[model samples]
Target chain A: MRIEEHPILDFKRGREIYFYYNGKKIKAYEGETIAAALYAAGIKTLSKSLRLHRPRGFFCGIGKCSSCLMKVDGIPNVRTCITMVREGMVVEDNDMELPDKEYEGCELRKKAVDVVVVGGGPAGMNAAIEASKYARTLLIDENPRLGGQLIKQTHKFFGSRRQRAGTRGIEIAKELEREVMERGVEVLLNTSVIGYYKRSHHFLAAADKINRIVYEIEAKKIIFATGAQENMLVFEGNDLPGVYGAGGVQTLMNVYGVKPGNVGLIIGAGNVGLILAYQLLQAGVGVACIVEAMPKIGGYFVHAAKIRRCGIPIYTRHSIKRAYGDGKVEGAIIGELDENWNFVEGSEKDIKCDFICLAVGLTPSIRLIAQTGAEISFINEAGGWVALHNEYMETTKEGIYVAGDLANIEEASTAMIEGKIAGLHAAHSIKPIDDFERKIKEYMEELEIFRQGYFGERPKKAKEKILEGYYEKMGERRSS
Target chain B: MKRWEREGVAEIEDIRLPTKEQLQKGVAIIECIQEIPCNPCVDACPFNAISMENINALPIVDFEKCVGCGKCIEVCPGLAIFVVKAKGEKATVMLPYEFIPLPKEGQMVKAINREGKEICEAVVKKVRKGKTPVVTIELPAEYAMEARHIKVKAEE
Candidate 1:
């Protein structure tokens, strides 16, 4: 089920290895995740739901979702999607059983830095690269490797030359990764920021899951570029094993060279869904069709055209009613929606697809920022409740900044620009730089230019509202 | 509703069709109608034939200045640009192709239109390989405007 040849990407698989999945031997690669290897072997069901005992597979491949949690090496609740496979590794479906072994003491390490940027995606990587120039920066991410979601993106990006437009996202990630390493930014991969405590100094409690150590990091400025997580569609049998997030499918096929399924029914017509349809076709997987609830296509017309020319149908004003299968996704029933947003009766059509990909939308990962007592507000256009930040990308809380999808659910180009603004601003606050004002202005201009398109209208309004709220809050605080 | 909006297949009227003289000299036909934030085609044109009011503006090609070098074909993230040239009865249509098993030179293939319908037979004329390979196919001059893609006979 592994894609042997792809036109856009060349998957460099590691040495051949094997792992035990439920007492059955599964062939794997050295660098692949347990979930990837299992999926390639056609084992869709990774774990069962705790309450309903329903079969569950990996959703968001970046370890944001808990569907792929499995028992690995006698430890329960290990995220199989992010956990790398080893030689002769033992991986079992989550049996809802706690580990019988006693908890061992983990090594505690203390570190101090000028800036701490969370999430090593496009935003955090750029932030680290810029911040490290003026201060000692520490970039932390929960993934086993850097680049966050960029590693799986094989399509070329859109924007001006400054944003690396026309270059594939994978290449942009590599360039940023190289810059981060060359800038002397201390990177902590496979480390999750567990908690943020406000004591005499700002302390971030991070746990390095792979190394089995806890890091207490104190920094002058903190940037939460924690990115976003895919939103789930509330359709019947959504908890089924084959219902995966769009990003998860990309990780399986593009990143790990594993086919998600024989045929897929994508549930959204946004850019992600459109790009995914083309990518799936490139990977030799059949796309049943794209079902969009919106009256008009949500993604760019060109993206939709790309798939349409390839003979893929896009059904607008339609939605998946339910997915049905015995243990996993076998197919899905879609129905046309009326003007009232209700499914028209007698318009249902059953699509024969082994998997359903949900690209509905994404919500910012605001947990760690919320933990910092930052002001959070519900901005529908901003992709749900996000931490309010000013033009400099600094949140309501002093010395703390937010960037990428955490600030707003926009494209990677905007996220990189925001990261640069936040990184330079944070570094300037730590130690004033001479050309800080000029650099920030240039980045802001680039960001404004990027947001002038029709697709940028909603995000533009949302950001203005957030800025208004930020200023209002600042004024109230000053008066009080 | 326009077919492009409903089905993502641009109609003949949606774009500026090349004149016979322009087609004779060859020109890059920009099918991009949406105003998204992209301007690589403008920069990709060494002749400065492609211009945009802003980064978000739709690309406008000056057929008079364009030499149909096909530089913009690979740079366009949307793969919406194509080069068409007339040669009496048969014409060449160059487009961006990213799929595996690229059609070999001189191979006869099925010429596909915007609606994914096979219109006529074409022969692979040339292929400029890159991250996003651009392939040129020769087909009937009448179908030059319709054929946006190619389906290799061996693929089927």
Candidate 2:
């Protein structure tokens, strides 16, 4: 199921190309990902689950989750969602990794920059753009293209004018990329950061999708806008072949114009879920309904209202029990949850559907930040274990900062603002800018606007506590 | 009210409406209550009537200086502002409308309330397809503030 007509986005009319999946011929566009090609060919079962040998489908199409891992040629564990398709490439489902054998034609190089920003989504881009103004900055992303989620976001954004309110995300992404390039920030696409060396402040990176050449980047300071990965719900047959993350479905449909399925069930009623539901409908997918475990809908009422008025039913206080199908998802079992969250007896009902999208939420990617010896604490209010940082977006460790979903699981707008703040902080620490305090105060105020009112009150207080915790920990270290 | 309750959000119930004297003085009512991160309304007013001190603070309007130009109505992204001019038993309500297949002039359409529920029918009078597109609908005086959205048809 692919979208033929869209109201806002004009999915580029790209030239078609041919690829090989399991040695069989599959046609795809030149710029499409392998997962998108296979999904468009009606191949949902990407690989077998690690345990039970059951089929596993796509989730977190951004390469965060291993559900979309597959063997390309002799390579195992290659993320198919971020891997671009080429002509006649053999794609198979299996385990693969950097081969144990001796290296062949591998290029190893090293370079240094004043600042390096990882994960070129909203955070990284904004970080690079802001920091490059004072220092030489290098921005890197694993995807072949930049703009992480913004590349797939087709809806208009919400924020003040400087935040690009009412502007579609893809357009905003292009604008950011333009500014980043114009500011002379070095950007490397299709490059993944492999590891970080705390002692040397060197980060190992790899590029060139299939056969990557490795390089080392030594940075005076580094910031991570790596973003977050989607969280999956556990249930009977939850690893079915047709299940995908709400963001994963958006990646397939909005980014590649390939709909996840003809009919689908969205499993969360939050902002991502509701937005995906509407985008799914816009992509010509018949959405059955939205299911939320919470007693009330979690997303903005304006967004929920758009779909409700458009005739999509939202079932609250209900959860999925199981997904059943012989080899692929054919339907789902849902039941009402009581006050204690246990399924009520005799409330099970079956919904016929081809796919289920999990929009439960996201868990931040804090591995790199923690590996750098930065202080990290598990804060559920901040969306899981996050690197403890001050209000300047500086982590406990010197010269290391965290921004975007990696620091907190907020969406794009906040990520953009945080990235700017972090980048400014890093740059100022190195080569101080003029009127730095005033500029920083302006940005902090800008950030506060997003973190205010009833919705933002929790994060506002949480941020205060995080800062307080950081100071206390530092105080303990100094006194000892 | 819940966050998504549609009505009662950006609570405009307590906004002070213009009295007959103030109405003759040409005042515009700022019903925005939610401290959302939007200020196009505050910036769009040319009469220096609307001001927001804090970024997240609700905008305040100086009724005496408000010329009722309805510039704020065109620029409000939330679609929360409205301009009311009382007629004998009817009033003209100017609102921001962005949907496609817009109602034609003199077209009788179903008028909806803040909750998006159809309450009555209204006649479309003016459609200003400008930088900030707006449509003026004439309805009963009681629905001056109630009618915020219009349903063109059951299927559109």
Candidate 1 reaches a DockQ of 0.82
Chain A TM-score, candidate 1?
0.97
Model 1 - which docking category?
A: high
State which candidate has the highest DockQ: 1
Tens digits of per-residue lDDT, candidate 2, A1-480, equal 666766555678467888777779998888889898898888888988676778888888999888888888667788899998888788987864565432367787777898999988899999999999999999988898889899888766666777887566888899999999899998888888878885566464545444556767889899988899889899887788888888988888989999887899999888899888878876768898888998887776556755664457788889999999988888999999999999999998899999999999888898777778888888878888888888888888888989988887876888998999999989998887887899889899888877875567767766877777788887753320
lDDT of 1 by residue, A92-146 (tens): 8776676653135778999998899999999999899989999999999988889
Interface RMSD over true interface Cα atoms for each candidate: 0.8, 4.4
| Alpha carbon deviation, residue A162, candidate 2 (Å) | 2.9
Error of 2 at A371 (Å): 1.5
Q: iRMS value of model 1?
A: 0.8
For candidate 2, list the clashing residue pairs, or say none.
A76-A96, A77-A96, A301-B4
- Lowest summed lDDT across 10 adjacent residues in model 2 chain A is found at A95-104
